[model samples]
Target: MTEHQALRIRRFSTDSAPVGERFDAWAAHSTYCDMVTTYRSDLPFDAHRDNVSIGPLILAGRTWRHPDPSLAYDAKRTPARIRADQRDFHSFSLQICGTAALRSDASTAVKRAGDLYLLDFARPFERVITPGSEISLSVPRDWLPADTGKLHGASLTRGVGSLFGDYLMSLYNTLPQLTRHDVPHIVRATTELLKASLHPELDTLAAAQTPIRDLLLQRIRRYIDDHLLQPDLTPGSICRDVGLSRAMLYRLFESAGGVMREIRQKRLYRVHQVLSSPDRPEERIRDVAWRHGFTDEKYFYRIFKAEFGHTPRETVEQVRHRRETGTN
Candidate 1:
């Protein structure tokens, strides 16, 4: 990875502190130290956290070790604390080793190993955390859909939930090798997985299963863009090449106003780009349209006008004028 894409990892541990002062040091280093009150057991407190910031999301791998397994720590976010802090964010924690009981006004559940649960920081909540390791993801409230409020304190361990939990673990494991170019795609996939796993009623879930559906959609779009200049780039060809059934292809692009419509729009965009380029001044608009798989000149002109609010000739003229005047 380039220097700019290099992963920035921050490690916080109580290992350097004296045994008597370890718990306080751990609390001081916590990300939510001010938002919650932490109570530790009498046993020696030992904790370690590694954090990586990926765009707007923060992914952390945390471990708490104590001599007593029954009670590691109790952290509570009270109403007064919430009001005083005014923090609004969502936390998705995947328990990797042990169990924890989470409670909030929206829901209450115990999350065991391999289980994932969500916490909304805007709401008051309590967590009786046992000695364990977990992968935690912190997402800004605005980054999630409004309906995600229902997921607060909800334990997810089945079906799509399991898939999401596994994805998080995999992402955490591979974070060290990822580049900056991968950040946007990771964020998009994470959002899609979260939406699919947390909200089943969403229309986007009808296309396919989470992560698989997300990957397929990306592949389809890339394939379409790569072959936009081909004349026989129809849904049948896409289905054949992308290994998707015709029904599944249609379902995948349903939210995009159907596959054929997407093709037409993409062609129109290509034609518009050609028309608006000063270097392509000698190329006729019809030839540009045909090159982009728009065979019917009249139909192309109509749709082009409808899409851009101007005729193809107008776009060329505007480009010519801007080139001559040396102005954008």
Candidate 2:
């Protein structure tokens, strides 16, 4: 098994403060200091918590009940903050459960749950964030292969609707299962999906050419992910859907072992999820496997044990045990 680093998480809270005093301090440590937020005086200030991390890429989830805060980051503050931090990054925010509006040099848009947009931290931007929840990614400029300028201020809801959004959300969902060794691949996939979302026209050329092979591979992986639960999902089906030949598909996934290996990996992971969920303690392991496209029970049992070093039955038992014992 390949050794990977564990995801590092840092959490912050206002400590139940009824005002924005402690919030200012918490926000500083949670993210950056170039911007300021003005909380609404009409609503009672409620406590807020931010779970933040930079595990290869920045992932932050924030929850608050206060009124939409007016946020601003200007030229003077941005320059000084950039000089101080010396880091150039773009923020892609997904409004998980909220109403908000963002304005930047390129565009302005209203956003709600299921909508995602990008903001260049180095530029002058302002946003009015309503009481809600959101998950955001802070990606470094160097990490992205494509130009970030084109993505700045662009709402990615439509561009990312197909595979990009699903891939990103899947990554976020699997954070608990990821290891440090997983960071490199995750980051690379994230970068590629971002590029594809910003410029889908390049996907065709991306595969045939060497300049963006990673992006092409990410595209193929996305397609496989979207069809993972289909019983007829196969290499041929994937090639047809992605407009690639079997030879090209094989060549792309060759480095990661093979196309079948990738599909199996994704399938096994999904099965693990069903078995692990405490709420689904009564779910049958065999049924879970079949739902994820595993047709052979004996083969599924053997591979499940090999892949996770534990039997499917054992995993379900453990989940039930955890639920009964109130443990994780």
Candidate 3:
């Protein structure tokens, strides 16, 4: 692909179109959709942009330096709109250059350079950035392994003097070095770091498993793992078991491709572990698959290969060959 085709960058400015139409277009298509921006009529307006998309994630470093202060509202993400959009993502505004005043239903603060704040598109909120530029990362919410609700309207200014602030800045600076193949792994690590920065006490697995009523994501993850072997592990089952509403459950696992996808992933991971273990020398591949609640041999083979890039029999043969040769 040509450089232009490889990068999906859309630019909007008052010089190209009428001011009202220009701002409206930028708000709709700039980063996340379902947003509306308003500016004062008396002041001059000038907005420029550069955005890069790595797989499902969007990194946009835009110029918020205009004469008039503006408010960007995420009002169109109602339940019906969310269903219509069919996209589960969140944006983190990292103040790369200057500060911006943020106002959400939960809190309000000045998000300065090195500060990172959650931008929830599913809920209604507005932000007023001063004359400066900021880079925002639009990430899949499920990719983040934390109760996103807890992060709504929250800010980690300079990550409380941690390297997380610098880490995010480095991510933005090094976007060109990442390829589509590397996006998923990069996103996962970034999410884990972001979660850790939010809750430092989340350093240990034991501390991570707080009550689900508190909307602790690790506990919900643990619950999912404990019940992954059950044949009836549906979204409804998870919601009922965890005492979370359907919407909340959906939100919790949105970036994970929803709860059903998560269950399949866990099952596939377990199957891979069994296939690779010497402790399972007596177990046949089919028996291991069945033990992991995979009843259809054909479907299991298909998804297993897709998930691991190798067949179950191939994995088992490799394990046996390695064991016999004393090679790991």
Which has the greatest TM-score? 1
- Runs with alpha carbons beyond 4 Å of true place in candidate 3: 1-15, 18-21, 28-44, 67-86, 158-162, 201-328
Off by over 4 Å in 1: 1-4, 33-43, 106-108, 201-203, 206-328
Lowest summed lDDT window (length 10), candidate 1: 31-40
Candidate 3's TM-score reads: 0.48
lDDT of 3: 0.65
Please tell me which predicted candidate would have the highest lDDT against the true structure. Answer: 1
Ten-residue region with minimum lDDT total, candidate 3? 204-213
Per-residue lDDT of candidate 1, residues 1-328 (tens digit)? 4633657888888888898888778767754633244554666677899999888999999898766667646677877778877878898999998778777775567888888988888887887778889999988989878978777887777777877787687678766656676677778788777777776565746532555566567667777897989988999878766665688788988998998998889878887887887787597777888888888999988988999999999998898899999999
Show model 2 residue runs off by greater than 4 Å: 1-5, 16-20, 33-44, 47-55, 66-77, 160-162, 202-328
Give each model a TM-score: 0.59, 0.55, 0.48
- Tens digit of lDDT per residue, candidate 2, span 1-328? 4454557666666765545465555455444543365443654445455443544578777666654455322212255666666667888877777666676665667777888878777766666566677778888877665586667767687844335555555555555545665565656566666776766676733632442355457657767787889888898888666555688789888988999999999999988888877777465667788899888999999999998999988987897788789887
Q: If both were scored by TM-score, which would come out higher, candidate 1 or candidate 2? A: 1
Candidate 1: which pairs clash?
none
Q: Is candidate 2 or candidate 3 better by lDDT?
A: 2
The candidates, ranked best first by lDDT, are 1, 2, 3
What tens-digit string does per-residue lDDT give for candidate 3 at 71-111? 43232344555566666677777787656666667567777
